[model samples]
Target: MTQFEALFDGRSFAAILFDMDGTLLSSIEAAERVWTRWAAQFGIDARTFLHGIHGQRAVDSVRQLNIPGVDPVAEAHAITLAEIEDVEGVHPIPGAREFVSTLPEGRWAIVTSAPRALAVRRLAAAGLKPPSVFITAEDIPRGKPDPACYQLAARQLGWTADDCVVFEDAAAGIRAGEAAGAPVVVITATHQRPMDTRHPTYVDYNALGATIRPDGRLQIRSQSTRKI
Candidate 1:
């Protein structure tokens, strides 16, 4: 469904919470290179490994893989270090910078499964500044699909679930935002939209527009139910 515009009727949020990798940064190629190499070393299928790890903490993913003789924490650390150095191909998703920059200062944040150092590196490499409030894997006790990361971000921003909206691209992240009780959800197809998808979706951040309401909350306008 294509359209020139659409209406996104929810905007009472005081802040917006965003996922990192797929939502904002276009780092799949970089991640693929690293994970593929790692998977090769472990005799694991890169496709399956990467799919299983999406939107998860590196340590958590490592544990889930159940790779024998691998120290999950140490492995995650090594991966993070490698990812930090693998800055090639890191860039912003289309319309990401323009849309994110339009957000009011201190009214938005990034909640990512990437460790703080790696997240910082990617944002820098992508030329996008991390917002004032960033909740990384290191700060999270649980990653996406747990809601802890999203809830933590809202709380740190002095907002609650309904007071913030979430923009996510991955299934785990969508679950996290929903679990966090975010009132408005914007699902981006930065990675790929699922066939059974059940959320307002966008091709990129350009599908959204924002204007401050009289009450000071942003009126997040978006195209209606169009597959983007």
Candidate 2:
């Protein structure tokens, strides 16, 4: 753990990239509710089906499933609509709000698999203000596990991927971050079980803090206090 802390102890970064759903907030309950219903409607086992789909764009997940007689685009649209209507249990991950609040505007961005409207709605539901640079499903032709979205996000922030750090909570997002050539930090906020990964992991942002250096680089720090 000491060695892991050493990675970010005094390092500075050009920008920070975040994945919205699981990283910034815990929307699993709400999302799974809608997906479970969608699975039932399509006669697919929700448990097995959902196991492999996190951090992927809905349309991409639908197309990959290739359900007979189902139009991937239309089905994805329906699912998105259902998700937008269900924010019942949506809430920010512990310490997430505080961590985000400390970030300077324009030094951070959100890259999500959700559509623009859905992303906005969920962020609002979770009591998180949307960042100025938000990359959503409609903004990218490809989704996670593909590095394009992360790369695009870094470029949007006027930095290269090598200069940014990505905070992710899903396997696909982690892969995307690594592939994009950025350091990845795993957030276990929404994990049901321990995940197998080499990246430094944090349960929440309670022990995390950050500040902008005089040179404008973002410095990530570990703290002993929690902010409610």
Candidate 3:
């Protein structure tokens, strides 16, 4: 079998965890528009700053800037509000809806840095249904790169981090998954160019599918010849 097809060969996972934004859907345009506006308000270069913010909690990303006189919490809240109000261009990644539909109910969760409200709005805008075990920024004390959110998501699904597979698209989320002891699948849907990663990577869910074995184990199958 090809490397892509061999990804989950001879293995089974108790659950699957996914990062919302760039993993299952694309909100790039809407997010960039709002962030650029916010950056302008703070006199920061939006283009350069956007690189460090994806996959991180807004407050954490803002706090890291350490901009004088800026309240990260308040600014993050404002950003979230703007994002929620602007769903223009929000849409599911290729094959996202079909792939998600193949999974068993209650065996998957969406772990996102977005606040619950924003997550819901984005999912709705993308025409995807929110999973039963949705874990959002408000549900965890820490965000991506911290592993708290992934761990919490695994726990909520009655599984350990190691028993679940994480689908991520950003550096922070990849680190979070590794730190949480979950194997990660890198989704490159939102990437501008190829990313150097050790994990199995895919451009989108177009070449993937999942099925429940008779033994009650979830098996992921990939048909693409894409490098992994």
Residue 72 of model 3 has an lDDT of: 94
- Tens-digit lDDT track for model 2 on 147-202? 99999999999999889999999999999999999999888878888888877888
Note the Cα lDDT for every prediction shown. 0.80, 0.89, 0.91
lDDT at residue 202 of model 2 (Cα atoms)? 85
- 104 Cα displacement, candidate 3 (Å): 1.2
CA lDDT for candidate 3: 0.91
Of 2 and 3, which scores higher on TM-score?
A: 3
Stretches of candidate 3 above 4 Å error? none
Q: After superposition, how far is residue 151 of candidate 2 from its true place, in Å?
A: 1.0
Model 1 residue 112 CA deviation in Å? 0.3
The whole-model C-alpha lDDT of candidate 2 against the native structure comes to 0.89
Where does candidate 2 have its weakest 10-residue lDDT segment? Answer: 219-228
Candidate scoring better on lDDT of 1 and 2: 2
Could you give the candidate ranking by lDDT, starting with the highest? 3, 2, 1
Tell me the tens digit of each residue's lDDT in model 1 across 1-228: 322222244436688899898888878888888888887888888888677676778888889888889999999898888888898988898888998888888889999999999999999998899999999998877788999998898898888866787888777888888888884355555555353456666677766777778888866766445554
- The parts of candidate 2 lying over 4 Å away from their true place are 1-3, 224-228
